[model samples]
Target: MKYLAVLILLVTACKSPTNKKMEPKTYLDIHNEAIVIDTHNDILMKTEDQGVIFDQDLTGQTHSDLERWKTGGLDVQIFSVYCDGNTKNSYAIANRQMDSLDAVVARNPDKIVKVANSKALLKAVEAHKIAAMFGVEGGHMIEGDLNKLEALYNRGARYLSLTHNAAPDWATSAADETTNPDLEEKGLTDFGIQVIKKMNALGMMIDVSHSGEQTFWDVIKLTNKPIIASHSSVYNLASSQRNLKDDQIKAIAKNGGVIMVNFHPNFIDNSFKAKAQAFFERHATEGDSLVKSGMDTWYMQDYLYKKYADEANQIRPPLATLINHIDYIVKLVGIDYVGLGSDFDGINITPQQLDDVTDYPLITKALVERGYSEADIIKILGTNFLRVLDANEIK
Candidate 1:
């Protein structure tokens, strides 16, 4: 009985602490050390609409406000000057967004610096300031004018997404152009090729996130510099047109381009698409009414998004699904060709776990848990993007 008691005590003492999980330390520590950069964010729209200054601590959104970005250890952010595709005067709207960003930077010059080249970006980083860069969100914002595109670059726009939702007469969109028989595949006209050439010359990264298949290939053929798909996901995973196909991924890799993954739920999760479609179907008539009333696409999307937020919550996937997109791209094109492009204020809904820029550490943690090496994590976090920026900068 004495021996049995001694054996029991030994067993109890040696028992594993199943309830007390070990904290993941190495990856988290490595994440904090890296200079994290997000290639795309749209929080400027909030600053424009609600008179919410990005310099202040904003409460409701899961994006970059001055304090939040600092706490998140975000080194650089490329704010998207996004205007709806359907706008007849998109250039004006783009100008307004750029003005708004300029105002924000002017108001908080100590916290952020507008960077137009790799040198400025590095200087801002060394100064411990958040390097602010611009990426015009749609090609339409240039008004089909190459001069306007050059002017945007001069104004510090680093990249330009080709088109938004609807296909221009010159290029097809990934969204509706493929299915609609009436839609023509204009690919890139001579003017579009010229646009690419000018962008290459101006050192603006040619973006192909929303462009159709033909346009993507056309840009790939025309540009000598490394291109970027600023906010896209893997079509092979979600089977959504908004995501890049395997062949497209290969092409981007061949051109030494990077595909930045978007955080929108529908783009990452197939299940969310059905729910979003149902919500849109229910509001179809109202949406059409708003369109007929000449309501701006931004307002229209905001209205519908507010209406469907509750339903969307039921179907939104976990944020890990977004990381899966990164994993998919890395598998296809190697780790050097992928990065983050969280479309923060541009999209109405994000994945469940990612609430704001502060939640970026979670992505780092997830990548580590997925068996990514520390060196690989650093590359995915921002190093790869910085290399691309250095490679493609005109100066």
Candidate 2:
């Protein structure tokens, strides 16, 4: 048996994969060669808040930073320009977030390139630079003006999600449906349809991640190009409003859109929200006191998680759970319609082993161990998003 093991090792010789050799490739080789893309990240929002400088090391502070993106083998990133529903002057906040990204790129021009379309994105990849693009996370940022949408496109935004957790007047959100079930005209309005058409014309992908069922169906019915659930998970596993239902996943596959699985534990694990809810309840008095003192709820949650890191880690799903969501999507659809969209800095809790942006290659290693061929791994990592981007970029 020992001689057989020696013979096996001697036969393979640890060579890289090739046509003639048919030798197994290392996970690092596959990951480095692949055009790794993450379609949803919130580091720009963190930068906007002056929470961390992206060009510097953000270890133990934020999930992403420029140097670490390279360390992580990230080739492309769609920086989400986001604002909550209650934000006053939402458009300005979105623009400010964009400005912060602009500043980061300006300071680190050699490392990152802000790309507007698929062509430019590929060019950046060819130049060995991280392609930075924009994704407006909420429709409310446009302020019901198609011109603002156009402005966002001109500023390098590649997608416009119809809603966030808080739906605007023109469109409903999943949270809206959950809270106001009896409301009439809950779907996309006439103006919302116009916005969709305008996005199509501008070559911006219609993102369905945060939308309600009506809005999702509306985009499927109206958009001329492929849609993207830029960052979401499977509802069957997690049952969160942020996760997609099976029918929605099927609809996206049928429409040739991609469902980029989100890595947020609340959206990835079925028991996460409940356990987290109870944990927060135990600290409700402190949380309420913090909130009353003007601390953001999200910030308070992060603080609590850090304070209870061990318990938090116990509740977080294993890294395999993230892969399981990807596997589920692949089983339901084909390999072409699923991708990675780790919410990273945007997420409160990531599954164990996915500590920061630097952990992306672990996904490649996991996929390889699961028997996904290199070509399939490449498409899942980034080409799926590129296919949709190219399909939308046909202007």
Candidate 3:
């Protein structure tokens, strides 16, 4: 009887509630456990244009580096392959950017790997390596050729924004559609519809971040698969042409798509552009000189931002403003449709607290303070984008 009582006590102790796995009690704990994915980053462009070494510690010079990505807990990154509309040999330039990414992965074999589908993405994440993917930022890179589009997909490009700030022959951009009154075409042309169908067929996600209102609607109507706004903010929050309107947000949600919020200050703060116009105007001559000296205008702008850090920092919005954009989307469509897509290395400035990739943990902390549960925070960090990626995969 004494031995039987002792054995029963031992069994009860082994099955105690304390033996269960503990929940993540703090922000870092929660953040480290989640599969954080940033759907849009332009570091490959930076590497190709500036000849900057991405594997080194690029603090203060660039927003991202290979080591810093791991430090920030970023598990997946869709590196943007981009060239402005006017560049000659745009498709070749896009391939050159892809080559740069390939070299990056080649050098850091253990730390990162290129992924073309959801299966490989999850595998890389599980192995504690960053799953790098390609996102062609302009359809103009395809140059109105479907073969070129297929070639990009074959090279591991998973998403392609229909336009940049400038319109392609097949699709109109928000910047041109809104500002170019004399422009004859306002949306996707017949060829643009064909592009959408081809992307759907190839399992490549169609991105509408830079697309005009008409182009966005055309894609929403035509695509049988879910789409992604790779890097854009809320139109109601900031009123930027680059941001998505309320109806667009609703449409995306209804279509089971995801709008990964952009981190550009101008896209997050309503009055940011007006406030920064004078500063940019002051630097316009220097900018033009840099352009004449053969530097691209986008790089020239980023250079100015780096040069006038103190002055530029003055116009950046608070971190809460960015969180407000996320909260707005969550309130409108619930937590399943929104995620992070920091246009790091693409934008010149971020919100005040979000200085670089390392600051991602701050977002998780902010979400926690705002009463978000762990599951919802995980969704916002990466699962929502993962869901869209999976849904768009070729069966």
Best by TM-score: 2
Native-to-model Cα distance after best TM-score fit, residue 355 in candidate 3, in Å:
1.2
lDDT of each: 0.78, 0.86, 0.89
Q: lDDT per residue, candidate 2, 172-231, as tens digits?
A: 999887778688777799999899889888889999998988888888899888899999
lDDT of 3 by residue, 40-150 (tens): 999888877788888899999899999999998888999999988888899999999999889889999999999988777777776778998999999999998999999
Q: Is candidate 2 or candidate 3 better by TM-score?
A: 2
Which pairs in model 2 have colliding backbones? none
Candidate 1: regions farther than 4 A off: 1-25, 277-312
Highest lDDT scorer:
3
For model 1, residues 1-395, the per-residue Cα lDDT tens digits are 24323432333233222225555546557666566789889886666665677777775643568878877778789999876678788777777788877887898888888987766675676667888888998888898888889888888889988877775555667765566677644578777788888888888898898888878888887888998988999998887777899999998888888888999887888888787778778888998899899886656766777676777566678878988899898887799899888888777777887767888888988998899987788778776777677768755
In model 1, what lDDT does residue 171 have?
62
Model 3 misplaced regions, further than 4 Å = 1-24, 281-295
TM-score of 3: 0.92
Worst 10 residues of 2 by lDDT: 7-16
Please give the lDDT score for candidate 1.
0.78
